[model samples]
Target chain A: TQTVSQSDAHVTVFEGDSVELRCNYSYGGSIYLSWYIQHHGHGLQFLLKYYSGNPVVQGVNGFEAEFSKSDSSFHLRKASVHWSDSAVYFCAVSARAGNYKYVFGAGTRLKVIA
Target chain B: AQTIHQWPVAEIKAVGSPLSLGCTIKGKSSPNLYWYWQATGGTLQQLFYSITVGQVESVVQLNLSASRPKDDQFILSTEKLLLSHSGFYLCAWTRTGEGTLYFGAGTRLSVL
Candidate 1:
């Protein structure tokens, strides 16, 4: 069974401030990690994904995430958040091989106040 | 590049009424399709998935059913919807040999 855990339910930051959202997963064997952002009343947009090679992956709109095997974690970060960046972020994981089913975290709602 | 589309951005249905939601995937063939439901401020739960035409796997049975009458198209339906069915429904698809899923705009359903 695959499961994802996102400890933080919410996070608040001021405009132009940096922020990081934490995510952890429980899965055996190799895995693929991904992050997605959902704006108000909009579809989810893929932010980034990590399969192998470099753990650090960059995504759209100045967002990036790092995959840490040692800690079983994949956390998303933004250099400077804009008010428009206020949205819900989700972390998901898939098996490295044939298992394509994705397990998603509960999500982290980020509020960027201007 | 692949794109997904869902219809009826919002809906208000009465109890015991039939409901139908549609989704289509473009720029990809024989992709894996999935339907998910998310209650307000709740975790996303996968309802069904299909890897090929005429074959769908249900992850959780929620008094609803799904169908893929054609490749690149998935439909979700409920004959008698209950108030518990009110929530956001999202449709997603992914190409073969890929793990990332592309999602639709999602339909917000309100069962009265």
Candidate 2:
């Protein structure tokens, strides 16, 4: 079974400040990792995904995430956050080979204060 | 451009009432459909998925069932609504080989 873990339940940052939301996964085989954002009262939107090649994948609205094989981690980062960036972020994982059942972490709620 | 739509944007119902939610995808053929539910302040949990017409697969058991009656339609239904059934229900779709999923606006269900 694949499992995803988002270590932080919430993170607060001021506008223009850098932020990193931690995520870690445990899987024995090839896996797909991705990040999604859900704004207040809205459904989830895909941010970015990593299956192969580049470890660092860029996403919409100036967000990026790096996948680490050794650490089994896929942490999302933003150089600078805007007030509009405040939302709930989720990290998901699935096995690349078979039974692509997506599993999500509890999510990390971001608060960007101006 | 493909579009996904969900019906009954918000619903309030008493316990033991029957509930049915619908989803439709347009401008796409043979798309993979999915149903996901999320509790307040919680992560999304995928309930069902369908790869083709009349072939719905349950990912998790929530005392609910899903059906794909047409190429573009998916329905979620339960004989009795429990308080635990109250949550946001979202419909999503992707191409046969695509990994990215597109989601609908979602239906907010409140079971009293």
Candidate 3:
């Protein structure tokens, strides 16, 4: 079974400040990791995904995430956030093969204040 | 461009009432469909997934059932609504050999 964990339930940051949303996962075999952002009252939007090769993947809106095998982590980061970035971020994981059932984290609510 | 649409943007129902939510995909065929539920301020939970017509698999049982009568349509229904069933319902789809899921706008259901 694959599981994802996002330790922080909420994080507040000032506009133009860099932010990092932490995510960690536990799975036995090859896995696919991805991030999604959901604004209030809206469905989630896919940000980025990592399967192989690049440890760091860039996403839309200047967001990026780095995958670390040793830490079993895939943390999303943005050098400078805008107030519009205020939303909930989710980290998801799935097995590379088999059922490919996607498992999502609890999510971290990010508040980018001006 | 592919589009996924969910019906009845929002719904309010009483307990013991039957409920049905619908989702349709356009510009795509034979796509894998999934239903997800999220409580207020809670994480998303996968309810069911269908890779083909008439073959729905349940991931978590919440007294809810799903069906895919047509290749492009997925339906989520329950015989009776429960307070626990009140939440946001989202439908998503992905092509074979693809990892990304495209989601619908979702339906907000309130059970009294």
Candidate 4:
């Protein structure tokens, strides 16, 4: 079984400040890692995903994530955050096998203050 | 382009009452469907997944069941609802062997 962990439950930062949300995973084989953002009372929107080829993958809204094999981590980063960037961020993992199950983390609630 | 639609944007049902939620995918054929339940302000828990018509697999036993009666439709239901069953229900679909998922607007259920 694959598991994802987001150590921080909540993160607060001033608008235009750089931020990084940590995500770590534990799985035996090839896996897919992705990040999603959920605004209050809304469904999650895909941010970015990492499977192969590149260690750093860019996502929408100037968001990006870097995958680290030795660290077993896939952390999301943004150069500067806007007030609109505040939302709950989730880290998900899925094995490359045919099974279509994705394991999601507890999520990190980001609060961007202007 | 593929679009996923979920019925009953919001529901308020009493405990022990039977409940049903529906999802339909348009413009996508043979997509994998999944049902996820999430408590307010909490993480998501995958309940069921279906890869084809008339085939559904349960990931966690939350006293809920799902069915794909048609290629484009997926249904989530339970004989009896519990207070704990009240949460956000999300229906998502992905292309075969693809990892990214497209989620519907979701149904917010409140079981009193």
Model 1, chain B: what is the TM-score? 0.97
By DockQ, the better pick of 1 and 3 is 3
Per-residue lDDT over A65-112 for candidate 4, one digit per residue giving the tens place of the 0 to 100 score: 999999999999999999999999999999977878899999999999
Model 2 agreement with the true structure over B57-78: per-residue lDDT tens digits: 9999699999999999999999
As a whole number from 0 to 100, the lDDT of residue A37 in candidate 4 is: 95
**Best-to-worst DockQ order:** 4, 3, 1, 2
TM-score of each: 0.96, 0.97, 0.99, 0.99
TM value for model 2: 0.97
DockQ (CA atoms), all models: 0.72, 0.71, 0.73, 0.85
**Rank list by lDDT:** 4, 3, 2, 1
The best candidate by DockQ is 4
- Chain A TM-score across all models, in listed order: 0.96, 0.97, 0.98, 0.98
Report the lDDT of model 4 for residue B50: 94
Where's the lowest-lDDT run of ten residues in candidate 4 chain B?
B94-103
Q: What are the runs in model 2 whose C-alpha is more than 4 Å off?
A: none
What TM-score does structure 4 among the candidates reach? 0.99
| Candidate-wise lDDT, in order | 0.91, 0.93, 0.94, 0.95
State the lDDT of candidate 3 residue by residue for B1-110, as single tens digits: 89999998999999999999999999998999999999998999999999999999999979999999999999999999999999999999988776887889999999
Which is the leading candidate under lDDT?
4
* Clashing residue pairs found in predicted model 1: none
